[model samples]
Target: MGHDLNLNAMNYFEAVARLGGVSKAAEELGVSASAVSQQIRQLEQQFGVRLFRREKRRLILTLDGERLFQTTTQAFRMMRDVRSAIVRQRENRHFIMRVSPSFGVRWLAPRLKGFLDANPGWDLRVDGAPDFSDFETEIVDLDLRYGAGDWSGLHQEAVVHDFVLPMCSPSYLAELKEQSGDPIGQLLKARLIDSVKTHFRWDFWLARHGAMGGRMVYPLRFDRSNMAIQVAADGAGVVLESATLAINELERGDLVPLSRAFAVIKVPTYWLVCPSRHTNRRIVRLFSEWMRKEGSAHDDKTADMLRSLGCTIQEEESTILNRDIDDARQ
Candidate 1:
């Protein structure tokens, strides 16, 4: 065999060996099947041995291929560890958290200052888009999902349980008070902002309030819950949204509760989810604990605000690991 072999050819061969097929490896590497085959052929010619035996469509790894795969696997893992360690050393610690868009924007985004203040020099990548299947493949450290925390292969921690409540701009409320004797009646007349995908509207709250008589009107319907809340803030309408989402706006006097027409909603709880194992990443552990503790702190703050207002508020809480999943369909 001639000794002018290329590392690039070996990489293609390694991909084929690990994936068990030239075509699949080519697809993953964004190259043509023929190109991958050519690279494998070049590698085998250089090594003076066939790395794989073709049986029908299957590419069975030969003895040489197996030996190469074991070595390459270790090499790849070591390379990954070195990259991660370098990043950690530069930033103190690395944290990548995946969370839903609305949750991240409405809740997490506003409160991240504290986390940043506490964990100075920590590198964090917050993915607001909610596809988590690739989290494992991408080596993501943590994911936050809004559900019962039934992620099959993740270490799950429940952060907070949430409820939907009627919210509107204070200006809208003032207008109602000026025009109508009863704010609830005026709210029924005001434009109703709809979160189209979540199927949340004033009718849902009206049903809970025993005033399901009015035909709701909508000036705008938003596909995103955040957009609907934005419209409500602009005095476009009254929006029914998760209290946790609207908390910052409410505290800042941007949004106000219209009435006590909020029903207990099953959706929109904070769950700290990640791959079922790997408790060894100190960054992951620290972020998870911080999420749970901070979520609890927010709940307590809400309860305290309610108490100061001369209203007794009942606070419900649950951990992700212990949340009741039996009533999912109920």
Candidate 2:
């Protein structure tokens, strides 16, 4: 309604919208409840719109409120990031590491503390980006990417050569077992989760086992391995993904092997990739070393779990999908 944007009102509104109540927003903002409420009322009047629908003390955003809140939240986040970047620039010994979103969220994120505690007086930023990072342009110090080592001119090390297997929730497995006695037949009838960006796919696994019958087409397809694994954990369907990434879920008994046929296809699951010039950074080497150890620990645990599940493991020999080049297309 005014020529200039009302920053204070917007900030107050964002706090209430995010916190779900005016009193909580006031408490966090170190302001009185009435002051917060006044800001909200003024904001509503300026826009000439009802922002929130009060439902038993919970502030539910209306359509217009939801739209404004989205923009405000993004703006605040951008401000925070800019501030952090500026602060890091003033400080020395800061490094940026890029990782695949799926791997970073499910696997590396939980184990990040070990590397930090071992090495202090340094700043480390972990970016879980879907796209492969352009090291030169992005100013990335380290990279953990999922793919076969195919990036030319880059010094790379296999973080862990991972194992892919068909895993599903306990409830889904029981329901799945009722459909067919034959393991292969059951998979054929069920919806298989296909992670399109991943090197190890459902078709490859099926073909390796010689169960290449029926449509062999997946109904549930996701771009990230973590997404497929999560849906499978929630009893959606059987997901063919890295057991290493699904360690927490497996440890929690959220997901189990669909069959006793354990698999260890030496396909590259994740790699510690960086430019040749950046390889010698002590921080990078230490992080890489820590990651490899963690990966080995994951493998050992996975192997023991598979054995407990009464599985007969087999290592498959096949070509792999090139990481940087092939993944860029998807």
Candidate 3:
């Protein structure tokens, strides 16, 4: 059989091997089960080898099948990468940025309209998730990372320093005040929602406020800070989170600080990171400067808000200025 004629059969066989059953492969390929089976059989005949073995209704790939699958997978991935590169190169006006989901949704999304309005000639594409893009393979131009700004082979600039405080819904706070008369004491006794990624725990916050040895009651843990913040805003429980990430809720009067005490975790600040090669690019420089200005403005606003609430924003020594950029460049 000609190689061109066997291409369709190979595709059907690959799908069957990957999906582990003929019916599943057929459903995925939008074809009938019998048709998929027939194509697999034709491929086997053409190659003069059995590609899959059926046992207990499960289709397992044979050695030949595994080899072919590996080759096809790499080929498809390369094709996709090539196509993406071509598309990105053809569109010279778009700026690709990557950021964590919480920052993207709570902070950047709100201010994006202003940025776009100010720069109508430029188009923005944001990829928001927990996963950072690999610049070697992906066409990511800028990354907003929550870290110590010490990543090797990248240009890093500190954008925002995070300060965390105990926050809860306003109604919940009112209810606590009305019930126990001591809102902080009532909060310590109530359910505590926490993020697993928090730099400091409730015990740390309690200790800083001289309320040590008071254990949090019925703690609920979430993987993301935004999830805990959302749950706290819905009056589920008190949560310890960055004031920066909860700025929207605070402004909307959905969440209120439970106390006048806060802890600044100096290690994890929002950093603007980009490939060394792209650091000198005009667009990267423009975005970095804009981010710095916006971040500084937000810090000032948050500080003012804290003062209004009679909360003393704790000052933590930051290594942002101490870091030797000379060593970083090397």
- The lDDT values for all models are 0.71, 0.81, 0.76
lDDT of 1 at 206: 64
Q: Write the per-residue lDDT of candidate 1 for residues 1-330, one digit (tens) a residue.
A: 336758678778878887889888999889999999998888888788888998998999899888987887777668869999897788676687788788888888888998889878887889887566466468677778776555676777777656556778989978877777675677667777777654245555565465555565567777777888878888877887766777667777788877543333434367887765655788777777788898888766765543443433433443321333222212
Candidate 3 residues 96-198, lDDT tens each? Answer: 9999888888888898887777667677899887887798999899998875666888888888777677889988877777767565677656678878665
Measured by TM-score, how close is model 1 to the native structure? 0.59
Q: If candidate 3 were superposed on the true structure by all CA atoms, what would the RMSD be?
A: 14.5
Q: Candidate 2 has which clashing residue pairs, if any?
A: none
CA RMSD (A), model 2: 14.9
Span of 10 residues, lowest total lDDT, candidate 2: 316-325
Write model 2 residue lDDT over 1-330, tens digit each, in one string: 457678899999999999989999999899999999999999998999999998886889999999999999999879889999898788768879989898888788887888779888788888889778787788889889877677788988876756677889999989878999888888887778898987767765676677867555688999988788889999999888877778778878999888875454445557888898886888887887888898878777777776776765655322434432233334
Whole-model alpha-carbon lDDT for candidate 3: 0.76
Give the per-residue Cα lDDT of candidate 2 at 6: 88
Q: Give the TM-scores of the predictions, in the order they appear.
A: 0.59, 0.67, 0.63
Q: Which portions of model 3 show Cα errors greater than 4 Å?
A: 1-91, 178-184, 207-218, 261-268, 318-330
Which 10-residue window of candidate 3 scores lowest in summed lDDT? Answer: 321-330
Superposition error at 229 for model 3 (Å): 1.7
